[model samples]
Target: MAIQIGFETLVEDLPGPRWQALFARLWPGYRAWFLRSGAVARPSYLESRRALRQHMPELVPTWQRLVELAGGGDVEARFLSLWCPPPYIVGCSQAVWIDPAGKEEPALLRNYDFAPALLEGSWLATRWQGQRVAAMGDCIWGALDGQNEAGVAASLSFGGSTVSGTGFGIPLVLRYVLEIAQSTAEAVALLQRVPVSMPYSITVLDRRADWATVFVGPDRPAEVTRRKAVTNFQHRIEWPEHARATHAAERLERLQKQVDGPGTLEDAIGALLQPPLYQSAYLRGYGTLYGVAYRPASGRMELLWPGVRWPQTLATFAEGRRDIVYTPGAEAPPDPDDAALAQLLTESRS
Candidate 1:
């Protein structure tokens, strides 16, 4: 199938008209996803709001504004809180690469692998929390990955597992990081405070070549490491089946090599644009929709594909759209060891 996705660049400094329009267009789908197991499956509105305030107190004002713009309904408020939301899985590969320039700038290179249909595809330049942020938006106000004016950039990959617990989703946590963190160490410290719903490996890079990959999950404390590259799994391969299905080990090895090399930023991106780093098994729930690079020293970012590069900086962000078609292969055949796969599936995600 040839999947067509329309990506938009909305340059807004606050929660206002443009944001409301986005919420109106995306709310219905988000509502359905939020209530997949029924409204009671999620926490109460008050509980959600309390969690937001307790963990991300700095974002309380912005969260309130977004809730108001989203129509101020109970479900809308809870959904925007991103507290204990539905379990979602995305396979991706990311790395921390330093430029070989005279000053050695740092770049966060990432490939967001997931279904094109499920991608919100919003590129936003905003100062919603008094700091300029250029980010790929998700959950209406959250970020898939983003950079702050202070030169801290971060990206995420789902840590391989079926385990989940009571906490906020990783997207909101990422949003909080860009809103307040000024460096990689600061970002890592902030990440440790927020409890996450799912396992995720967040790679953070700052302008001074300071970077670390922080591994976080609902059931465990966040772990900050000097590792330069991360794929879906973290620490060790927790989900062997998923690790195999997504070629997680292979992809991680490739990214680790790239991050460890003395390659330029362009060289890192070039490696990401090719296989087995570039994924296409959309039917199996992981396809490389777009590759992105964040240059903290230069205060710029760019998106990449096979033949396209969309570059922008906070000062020169343009409001526009890119409609790209993705042609991905079908799902791989099921494993012969159905009984083992079935047992893995029985693990509770709640």
Candidate 2:
């Protein structure tokens, strides 16, 4: 049997009752996890808001409006930044510009690998018509990855760096870009201006088949490259700890091999469902929760998993949707070399 994950679509204007309901549903767990994490650099609500205003002033009013819309209780904007400090995300792979042959239009494929517990009560899909953006994210009002109506799509991966600083998280950055940027060029320009707290790589793709992958962080100058895919590291593995911990290189190779073989979109997706890309380690919360392919030209999205495929557009998704759960059907043996790293991550969290 296939696991069924429930995804709700939200299309109302900002600060509506639905937004409040979602906040109420997701805030408790989000708060609990934040408390459990004992994040030393977690900013206060005012501090976070100040940083937002100073760096991305375009979003401050919007965020304030959302807080007001969510009933302006005790919820503070800083809670949203809790995950910005580069949590121990071990595996993720993304492919942009996967096809120029027009076999299926250019697409962006990503596997959001992280601890499963972090996503509790928060796998909500949002289509904000007012903002003209469609994204998948949690209660923090940040985007995990999304495409805008302007035919620009962006997705992120941990940049495999231990470097951290007092800057904004990548999820909110993604939200800002998706909401404001219309093309790959625009998105690239916006990335240059933003300040990021942790190392991350964002793959940007526009409807015209134009793409760029940018590696950015608080520690180093941003570097952009025209590429078909990116996984974890960029240029060099600045974080030796992660080099020992992750299989990012192997996953990248898998994607490269598929792309070099002139593989179709389906073939790439198939590779994503296998080892490294599609993880099965639920005990460590590193399993692949979901996989998505975005077609920027048509503003269409295809959700794929074992034994199921659900297609939806921003407009149609609001009318109807399905909850797809990912149940690990088969267990892949753990890589012995990586076991210690996984254990260390689990212990660090504990």
The C-alpha lDDT values of all candidates are: 0.86, 0.70
Error of 1 at 38 (Å): 0.8
Q: Model 2: per-residue lDDT, tens digit, 267-301?
A: 88888778777876555555677778888888888
Best by lDDT: 1
Model 2 misplaced stretches (Cα beyond 4 Å): 1-5, 36-41, 70-75, 81-90, 120-129, 238-246, 319-350
- Tell how far residue 95 is off in model 1, in angstroms: 0.4
lDDT (10s digit) by residue, model 1, range 1-350: 68889999989998899999999998888888888789999999999989987899989998889888887899999999999998777788999886555455778999998767778999989998888999998888889998999999999989998789988888889999999999998999998988999899999999887999999998899999998888988888988877887789999999888877777777889999998899887655578999999998888899999899898987788888888888886666868754453444322121
Clashing pairs in 2: 3-325, 4-324, 4-325, 5-323, 5-324, 5-325, 6-323
Native-to-model Cα distance after best TM-score fit, residue 151 in candidate 1, in Å: 0.5
Per-candidate alpha-carbon RMSD to the true structure: 2.6, 3.4
